[model samples]
Target chain A: MSELLSITATGLTKRFGDVTAVNDLSLNIHCGEIYGFLGLNGAGKTTTIRMLLGMIRPNTGSVSLFGIKVQPSQSSIWQRVGYMVETPHAYPDLTVRENLEITRRLRQMSATDAVEKIIGELGLMPYANRRARTLSLGNAQRLGLAKALIHHPDLLLLDEPANALDPAGIVEIRNLLRGLAENSGVTIFISSHILSEVARLATRIGIVHEGRLLKELNANELAEQEEQRLAVDVNDTVAALSALGKAGIAARLDGKNSLIITDKPTMQHPDKVATLLVEAGCPPTRLVVEQRDLESYFLGLVGMKEEKKQ
Target chain B: MIASVKAPDNIISKLVPALWVELKKVQRSKTLWMTALAFSLLIIISGLFMYILKDPEQARRLGILGAKAQIFGGSANWPSFFNLVLLMVSLGGLIIFGFIFVWIFGREFGDKTVYDILSLPTPRVTVVIAKIITAAYWSLALILLVFVLMLGLGAMLQLPEWSAATVWNGLGLLLGTGSLTVLICIPFGLVASFTRGYLPAVGCIFLVIILGQVISQLGNGQYFPWTIPMLYSGAAEALIGKVTAPLGLISYILVGLVGAISLVFTCGWWRYADQT
Candidate 1:
């Protein structure tokens, strides 16, 4: 069962002198899957990524990339891995081509189709000779990603890969990442706070909070949980909401006369609602079911009340 | 989509990429090269002018014997312009080399690009080692270029003073001074790793330079820790023929013990820098 695991981190812990940035975190990422690691600000996502790259020594536990226990001194496993960490900086002086060549030499890659391959694939042929420093932010990010992609690793770990990208750049990155995973079966472990993008790109997701795992689920499951709410428009929303409650259904006021039915409402449940509304001197004018979004499902899990703050 | 990386055989090979990567970044910054070139040219031009003005007869001697001739001032007028050039360049090289080393490491943090550096295929230790060697290579290149340039400058200026002894003294001084700069770099580099900005590293280098001068003033100061690189060999200083026992003792203190210990600490302590 575990043979197919591309990355398996167990009981990983890292600390500064006084603060525990990541504590006893365990994660399993199967092969050929896009796993999103989600968390808010300063939630140890960056620290965990560093450990897997063997950039830091975890105070305890272990991290294995491609099934080999990653060691601080031993760097063999990196050959099969590609990574982009937070706020990545590129060689400002090097033209995009020179940057690619340097990475080529470091990896000891041969002079064969290597240059043409990366250039052709990353669509970087246009900016090949332009000095990296002069490229705009979106261009620089594309170049940074291009540099990372040159090695063609089986596993790609990208931290906020799309953070600095503009909308079009973000779409390009998502498409490219998806293409890589689909064509080459590369397992990607990505961490981001952008839930909508994560939903679109990830096949599986592991949500992290305060240096601990909150949940792990497939995109389908998280989405399924959101399709439960119904939106209703009516007059006398207070009477209507009470009408819904007395009818053994729950509804919340969205505005003066608008209500959202949070619980699933069958045909019989609506009859109970209508009867209660007549007794409370209020009747519904219109009703419609609203498709749920993962955001609300997430808020539900974390117990965030939807107070129409938006 | 990794296709560019070649797995290095061991720690040393891995370190090369890291060093190469950093050097590439340095090269990307035009200001870095501007500073290095300006420093080199300033030393070469100044040393050349002084050699020609001080000893006309020696300057008049156009012999490319590449030797140091004993002249009016023990160190300054040592026959060939090479020795004069070495002394001046060494002053600039010591600070520039150390500053470059510190900036290479310090800038990564100060600029907040350290994560990009360490996240490459190689480990952080390899990255640190790479920065060390990258700075060493540039510094060494600067030293050798000055040595060769001085020899050429002597001919072009048509100086009468020329000898093989001058070459020996110049090479000797460069080596000693270069070694000292390398040693100075280790501590400053350490300070760079911990600090918020590049200023701390630059500050420590200035402090070392100032303190070294004060110690030299206390007594015969042209030896060991004082001159660093060539202090042990006393080549150019030997041409000048002025290395006191205390100076030699300081040289030993710097090259033999202090430098080695600092390297060990940096390796043990800074090998796995958190880099934030």
Candidate 2:
């Protein structure tokens, strides 16, 4: 592994009995890069995260973090890495502060104010004295994040970080993570099933489907991958469809009675379609260029892969 | 020019913080207080029996107590009281101490918090060691508290035979039997770890208790880890007149080996086994 790489997993493969959980998985996450691992629910996201953290050893390959080999015995590497595998859980009987204190001690953080600072940063100050079992799901998730961040780790591996959070809490965590990456240069590997959530913060996104990386794209490249179309609304949808088809621009009516044009030429030139509709005596009521959102693109990729498998 | 060097990390420094974390979990949970309450109740019941045995004439007026007291061969002296306490400790310690061990190890799985500790600056083996140490001391503290309660109850009842030798011997037997019982409870930590829950481990404890009672009745109590403490405490002799000879060193060796193997296996499981 290169010295600049924070995480490197080469040809990693894990199998649970006959089921291959992760197959031929390889990653090279650089220092201070936010790598979003996008997958569906059972798409081997958590399994891959566990393998990265050395919670589960890969059957065929290996992982290294911060130039040190990732193994159960390598305790020093964890000093610079923080992670939350799945739904975060705490000792139900301990207060929020006490739970954080336990994590602080286990992480060997000597600073006295580390617990209080994290509690305040995660907006958990009100529930600091409250027992963990009594906190709401959002607050419990915050406590989990606080534990991971209390040590000021250089690399964070979060699986479904937005799980069990309200919209505002999600935005707050997003901003916090963005600030960490921008200011402190913390390298984060976040895995989530929601592409929209990951797309908003991830600088590099890896789309995984059925335990295989389908595609990897930079944040800017994601826009290029999205399928574009020109949706046209008119008083007579049938007339607009015929006009576009007669003009050799293959178009179909969508569920909402709008003409959907997937041809590149028509997508690039919506004004030409407007002129065609005007000449056809059904002036266009609406003509707008539309691009697929990140979520649909993700589903299309996964669905396309599934179809190929079948 | 001057040279600066960093100190090497030792196991003690690593264990201290993990041990502190484990002890904090033990202190904050209700299992400790509940087990103490259960042990106290057992002690109070032993005292009630001692009171009944002390006053058989007063018990004769009561129906069942009169009949039971007549058939009882043991008197209500300090020696008999100490014997009763030892027998109770040997039998009750298996259930209580076994529970403490399971709770300390298995609660991490039950509460779904095992993953957090698995990857940390502290190694997994260190975490296991800290838990085992906490469980050991916690079991010892509960045994000590019950022993003190028994002493106070004996004083209040004013049983005869107050020799210093008798007190010392009783204390020795209680501590020895309690220690042996705690030793056998170590394997339950392994059971809890591999099974990933408390139900199987708790069931295993009860199975061991039943088998220990039956096996002790069959005169092979010296070989069984669960029955060794009872045999050593002379409970087999006092309760059923079955065990006559004193336990040899082999019995203690067997208990120690069981504990050592269990500790090793627990640590190895945490280190090598896939936690998923």
Candidate 3:
């Protein structure tokens, strides 16, 4: 209920007949923080976003925005919150400028030039006069973002906002969202399946799998927890294993015929492992330190790797 | 710091902007032009039928006339022409006006844009009301277009039996029938919202039309909300009894009641039901 907490949901659950879309979920997002909601398709990410936006009511529990309970009849709370639930959609026949203009009027912004300003900010000026149906998917996503940001809301909830964007467009949106949070104190709750995208932008990240939040971590903590390993290529595998074992370093051979050392000591000092291997008369052919990427880390966190194994 | 300005917390303050947005959307939709063209074509075809009926014997010699003139059912004059206009409004207005309501509400779901409008500074009820207002306004515009064309075409063909009183009475009947037809079509907005698409709403319209005809044949047309307008326009009085007997206060109340109930349901759905 604190004012500083822009979003608070407690025991939120939604059921569609027999299927539970969101189950016993609770989370808090503070102001000026970009909270990345990472989940696979149908992991209840969009459902949770819908609940937050009051598009769908929870079967149980509650959601409060800016310390006020969210309800469909409550209009004042929405003035400070902007959201794009799933895929961004606009009236296909309307031009980009006209679509943004509609949002401006509906948001009740007195500024007549708000549409033009958003167009320029989202780099949509080139296609401002073009019909939405005629734009490519990437441009359509930009128009959707433009509509959500037109009023410069204090809170933004975007669901898979970078769905159809190209690489550069994704980076552009990431920078835009990051800037909004840092410069304007906008609290953002963005959901995406792309771990690298969220890892790069989110101040705090929540991973949801199977209608449950598995873990929550800061960006720096996620970075520090990324798996690092010392890989060694030696002439003789038996001699290298014996040498590393004699040195009290646990080492195992990976599937690709390379010795993999994931223990903290050897991973911290690959040079020491190389010396041990050379002194044992097994000259090292390749000694390298490799870190696991965000995708692998995310897949591991969500138990997707275990599922894949089964 | 990002300055936050709260929207005024009143229905009137919310309605203006919501109505503006609804008007803009309607202006840009192709459905508006499509409906206008369909209605215009019906008026022009009715005028053409009247022109052909003016002189059947000479027209028979010209090979342009055929058994189609029999369908006119009466002499080619201002009275019959106005009656034809009334018939068209009562019959065709059901589909055309129903289509306007369907597009105004169904297009939000069809285009998958309902979520965008659900969580805005304007209340969801305001959005629903705005759509209803837009549908009514658009239906009225199309009705006016049909009336103007009927007048101009009647003049050009120079049909006989023209008088100021006839024109006034005919205009009044046509406007009354059009309003009644529009009123009944409001429920389709609820159907569209419930079905969440255009095809289902269109199916509902056709089903209502068929049921209205069947009910009228059963001699109970006056009591049916869909058939009351047709009966009031004298479309079904030949088969049924006097229009006034069946179309009592209860009948008008039924039509208004259907509209009121449908508006309540549509607004309630928008405000309470889940968008998914």
Which candidate leads the pack in lDDT?
2
Which portions of model 1 show Cα errors greater than 4 Å? A231-246, A250-260, A266-275, A282-289, A303-310, B1-32, B48-86, B110-113, B117-127, B156-158, B220-250
Q: Going through the candidates in order, what is chain B's TM-score? A: 0.76, 0.93, 0.92
Query: Residue A238 in model 2: shift from native, Å?
Result: 13
User: What is the lDDT for A255 in model 2?
Assistant: 52
Model 3 chain A worst lDDT run, 10 consecutive residues? A301-310
Error of 1 at A17 (Å): 4.8
Better of 1 and 2 by TM-score: 2
The regions of model 2 sitting more than 4 angstroms off are: A231-260, A268-289, A304-310, B1-8, B66-73
CAPRI verdict on model 1?
acceptable
Chain A TM-score of each model, in the order shown? Answer: 0.86, 0.86, 0.87
What digit string (tens of lDDT, one per residue) describes model 2 on residues A196-288?
A: 888899999999888888889999998776777787888888887787788999988765557778889778888889999999999987778
Name the candidate that leads on DockQ.
Answer: 3
Model 2, B107-148: lDDT tens per residue?
999999999999887889999999999998998898789879
Give the Cα lDDT of each candidate.
Answer: 0.70, 0.86, 0.85
Worst window of 10 by summed lDDT in candidate 3 chain B: B235-244
A best-first ranking of the candidates according to their lDDT comes to 2, 3, 1
User: Per-residue alpha-carbon lDDT of model 1 for B196-230, expressed as tens digits?
Assistant: 46987788878867877776556545543535553
TM-score of every prediction relative to native: 0.83, 0.92, 0.92
